[model samples]
Target: MSSAEGNLTWEPATRHTELLAGPVARAIAATPSARVAPIDAELADTAAFCAAYDVAMESSANCVVVAGKRGGEVRYAAVLVLASMRADINGAVRRHLDVRKISFAPMDQAVELTGMEFGGITPIGLPADWPVLVDEAVVAAGDVVIGSGIRGSKVLVPASELATLATAEVLPLSL
Candidate 1:
C-alpha cells in the first residue's frame, strides 16, 4: 500500500452543482495505499478536464456508470475507461452485464441511485456487488488520473496500483 499525497484537504463539491465525492472517494479510502488527489471541481467533462490539466487521456481514467434492462432484469454497471478511449456501453457492456441491451443511465436516476453528483461518479465505492470493468490498456498507462468520488477531486495513483486497490478485472473493453 503506497499513497501519493498524504491527507490533502481539497474542496470537493459541497452542493449539487457540478460534482460531489462519493463512491470514487470511498474507493480511494479503501485503497490500502492510495491517497485522494486534487482536481478542479468545475470541469465540464472528462475531455475538457484532461485538456485543461494537460493530463494525457491514456493516463487519465474515466468512470462511466451505465444502466439498462434485459429480459426484465434491471442492472447497473460501471466501466472504467482511458480518457483517450470511450466506454463501449452498447456492445462490450451489454455482453459483460449479460443484458439484452444497455444505455447511459438517465441524469436523475444516476444521481438518485449513485448518491453522487452527475459527472463525478466513480466505480470505486459503488455497492460491493456492482461489476467494475477496467480496460487493460488503461491499467498499463500507470499513474492514472480518475474521479475523486467528487467532480472537483480526483485520485492519482499508479495504474497497476489502482488495479490492485480495487481488485479490478481488466479486459479489452474500451471503445
Candidate 2:
C-alpha cells in the first residue's frame, strides 16, 4: 500500500462485495490487485475523506460523470482526475467527446444510471458503452484511492491498472 493510504485496514475487494455497489463488486472481482477499506459514510467526499483519514489529496482520484450533447443526441462518459485537479469539462473533455456542449451529469441521473451512491461513483463499473477517460497524471500516480461505488468504503488500486480497463482512454483530461 502507498504511504499516503490512510489508517483504514485494506482487504481484498472481491471478498467484501457488501461494501460495494452491485456493478462495482462484479467489476472489481476481475481486478486482483484491488483493495477495499471501510470508512464513515459522512466523509465519503474527496476532501473530507482525505482529511479525516490522513490521506493525501494527490493520492486520491475522483470519477465524475458527464453528459455531452450534439445534434439532439446525448452521450455519457466517466472522467477520472486526481483530487488535486479538476476535469477540463468544457475544453479537453468536450473536444474528446466530439460534442457541442458538455457538462457534469445531474446527480440523480448519474446515480441512477451508474447504480452507485451520489457521492461515491467510480469509473470501474460504468455502462459498457460509456468511455472511461482517465487523466494521464492519474495513471502515473501509482497506487491511488477511489470511490468503491458506495459512500461507506473506498477502493485502492494501482493507477496503471485503471488505464487498462476495456473502455478506458488515457488523456490529458485535467485542468
Candidate 3:
C-alpha cells in the first residue's frame, strides 16, 4: 500500500501497536509523519532492507547502542546515523558522552535492555537516560527509514521529528 504522497508502501506506524510497543508505539502515534511497513524478517538488515524496499541507502538511518564506563559507572547511548557513514564512537560520541572510551553494546545487553531485536533497534523507544545522538546528516535527510523495534517491519519518519525527541541531540556523529 504505497502512500500517495511519497509513493511509499508505508502504513501508519501507530497502526501496528502490537509489533511496536512502549515508547516506539507512543512516538509513532505522536509524530504526524511517522509510517511503518511490514517486511520479511530476514530483510531487516540495512542492505537487504534497502534493496528489497527500493529505499536509498543514504536515507536509511541506523540506531546503534554503545556502552562504556566512567569512574566505575556504566554509561549507555543510542546513536543515529545514516547507513552511508559509521558512527564516530571514538571521537564524537565519546566526547559527547564525556566518557574516555566507548564501543558497540554487546548484542545480548542491547537486546535485553531495549527489548528489541539486534537488527531492529531504533531511537524511538530507547531508555530515557540514554542520549539519542543523531548525526547532522540524518537530521537533514528529510524523511528516512528506521528500525521498528522488530525485524519484521520498519518505520518511516521525518528527520525533524526525530530531533524533537526528548533525548535527541543533533551533532556530527558520523565519520
lDDT against true structure, model 1: 0.66
lDDT string, candidate 1, 11-53, tens digits: 3222222333555544444554444545667763777777766
Using all chains and alpha carbons, the TM-scores for the candidates as numbered come to: 0.79, 0.98, 0.92
Clashes of 1: 6
Locate the minimum summed-lDDT window of 10 residues in model 2: 1-10
lDDT per residue as tens, model 2, 1-175: 4655778899889898888999998898556788999999999998999999988899999999999999999999999999999889999999999999989999999999999999899988889999999999999888899999999999999988899998999999888
Tens digits of per-residue lDDT, candidate 3, 64-96, equal 999988897889999999998998899999988
Residue pairs of candidate 1 with colliding backbone atoms: 20-150, 21-149, 21-150, 22-149, 41-152, 143-159
Clashes of each: 6, 0, 0
| Candidates, ranked, TM-score | 2, 3, 1
Of 1 and 3, the candidate ahead on TM-score is 3
lDDT of 2 at 163: 92
Top-TM-score structure, candidate number: 2
Q: Model 3 shows how many backbone clashes?
A: 0
Better of 1 and 2 by lDDT: 2
TM-score between candidate 3 and the true structure: 0.92
Assess candidate 3 and give its lDDT.
0.84
